[model samples]
Target: MQETKPQAVSRATDEELLALGRDVLTIEAEAVVALAGRLDGSFVAATRMILGATGRVIVTGVGKSGHIGRKLAATFASTGTPAYFVHAAEAAHGDLGMITAADVVIALSNSGTTAEVLTIAPLIKRHGARLIAITGNPSSALAKLADVHLDATIEREACPLNLAPTASTTAALALGDALAVALLDARGFGPDDFARSHPGGALGRRLLTRVSDVMRTGERIPRVAESASFAEALLEVTRGGMGMTAIVTPDNHAIGIFTDGDLRRLLGAQTDFRGLAVAEVMHRNPRSIAPDALAAEAAATMERARINQILVVDESGLLVGALNTHDLMDAKVI
Candidate 1:
């Protein structure tokens, strides 16, 4: 057969394109907003069912609903609820075995008549698993069979032809997110728990990293005895390159801190350079944090005190390490 060339259509003006984009967003936004009003006891019941389940949440759908299901499953799993997506069509072809009596199945279908999802809905229930259906039609067979039906009905699709799934899918996704957030709150999921699931992310670095992990220790720390001359402390500061030096006692307990800022202020006030004790100009009772404290806490302390450097001290107040804003930045803890 000979192939025929396609005819070209007229291009849309920029104004027309912008208007269409705005319309789509408005429609989808309205659909999601409408869902908030429809939510009743059924929403709470679904959350309680999932919370009480001993097994995982099995999210299943097809087409655009499947895409939403995959995202919802990931959101659920990351936010303390154990969940995973299973394609409805695949569920019929041996994947149904993945569901169990203890599991709670969440099925997504805008029309609530998707054959692929309906085919395995009975088997899912027969396995003793409870079904939570999200659909546009409450009277559809799938919704009728569900233990709890979440109405996702929308006035119209965002698509110009009103055929493609758009507003409906967005509403379904927003509903799923609401469910997941409810479960997270119920389980008291916190930032620390979230950090554990996302250790490679910035929040993980801030929450999991400790002061000792990024502090300058040993010879890297700039230190001077209380009896040291101002010149000697300046030498240690320049050599350590931390822009500051810790003033310590004979037992190495931090007593004060001297920084480049203090040096500038002193130079402005007095020009005597022959003999000056670091103890005379050093800031006494410097802010310090424990080595085991979180690096984020260190950052907070520095920001609150408006200081660039802080000393890390042990239980006995002995200087163990030192860190500045630069070190926190290097570790990406801030």
Candidate 2:
């Protein structure tokens, strides 16, 4: 049969278009806000169940809800909770075997009556796994079958036709985020843990990288004794490729530092390099950082001090390593 042509419709005015856009946003935002008040014992129970689960969280849904479930599963996994998304329809086709008694199943369906999701609910129960349902109608079959029902009921859809999933999906996503954050806090998932999960991301590099990992150590460090001549310090700086040299006492404790900037001031004064010792011309109490500090912290210190290089010291205040802004750049920690 030939497809019927869509009826010609009148174009909306600019004002009408703007009003519709604003209405959609306002409705969705209000739906999310109202979901906050609806949190009750069921919310708490869902959180505790997932937290106590020995296996991963299996999130399942169909259509738009499936898309949201994928995102929720990712959030849970990245935040220290092990989780994976399984299409609700696929669960009835052998995927249900993936569910174990140790795992927790979180199913999403706005009406609490999605046929595919409902079909797999019994198998999840038979596996002895706890079921958490996020749906709008708690009186529906899916809600009644769940071990914990999270009420995601909304006043209405943000869609103009009220047919497409809109406000309901937004509420479901927000509820998923809420659950993930609560579980993250309870498990004490910190920045380091987050970094470990995202090693290739910028935040991961900032959090997991340490001063020791990037700082130049041992022979790579530029150092000279306090008694060394200014010429010798310059040679050490050039050899180490750091543009500066640390002046250390006989006990190997850094007493000061001399940089290219200091040389300029000496040159302007016409000071005789032959008569000057590094100890006399070097800057006293130079800024330093601990080797155990985060590379990001070192970057912050350098930015605040307006300096390019920093000395890495041990607990005893002895110089162990050194690094400059260039090292941070190479490490991608800057």
Candidate 3:
């Protein structure tokens, strides 16, 4: 008999590889859309249960589900819900004591039969804490034991081998987001509330920070009497370190403001700084903000007016403080 060579399988072309990528995305997207349709009264009940709980939400899971649980817990905490993550394996070893009757436990398990989670399920029930399950299999033991089961099932895995968790994990994460947003809406959690939870971030600065927090007060405020010479105003501006000085009335109300830019304009007119009064070259009705206004609002006002500095005034129109763009930047409110 004559020897024969075996035929080799052809490799995928660039077009074929691109098509495969699109197919994976399409599968995952469809899986998420399907979860939306699967949502029912159970989801509403779960949201209510979370809202009604007097204590924090305890999230637990294993493997990839555990990773998702951490993010879910963080999202919950950041969005007005008191929540924290507990590793399922650790729960089996004595972490179950963390669960109290005041808490509601959310367990993530794609198979709904994860051994580590199953080990602690009954203990949670005994503690009088309600159990909410997010799982791909509604008929799984975890779902059957849950007070409310959220269906995160998908028709197929995005992985070609049908072994890895791709579409299922995406569905579970989307479902978690849906639940958190629903709770957020029900509780009327606004930007101000969100800012309180994020004091060190930009969003916090924009919403929680006030002009009074970043403005220069006391002797740091650059100011001069309206009758003072421009040379005196220049000295005040230099001492204040701000680019401008406020020309104030005898009662300390700001009548006008003089800036370095004003000096350039004055030089254009061949005027001597010592010969002019502070009021002569000052800008009347200069842009001013209230000390209580949000720092973000101040930044916006400066941007719209195309100015670098703004005066902070009290309700009496007195110059109580002053700030420049640099101050706002340093405060991280710009």
**Alpha-carbon RMSD to native, per candidate:** 2.3, 3.5, 5.8
Higher-scoring candidate on lDDT, 1 or 3: 1
Best by lDDT: 1
State TM-scores per candidate.
0.91, 0.86, 0.82
Compare candidates 2 and 3 on lDDT and give the better one. 2
- At residue 84, candidate 3 shows an lDDT of 97
Residue 253, candidate 2: C-alpha displacement in angstroms? 1.5
Report the candidate with higher TM-score, 1 versus 3.
Answer: 1
* Candidate 3 worst ten-residue window by lDDT: 271-280
From the highest TM-score down, the ranking of the candidates is 1, 2, 3
Candidate 2 lDDT, tens digit per residue, 109-197? Answer: 99999999999998899889999999999899999999999999999999999989999999999999999999999999998899889
Q: What do the candidate models score in CA lDDT, each in turn?
A: 0.96, 0.94, 0.93
Off by over 4 Å in 2: 1-26, 261-274
Candidate 3, 25-127: lDDT as tens digits: 9999999999888899999999999999999999999999999999999999999998999999999999998999999999999999999999899889999
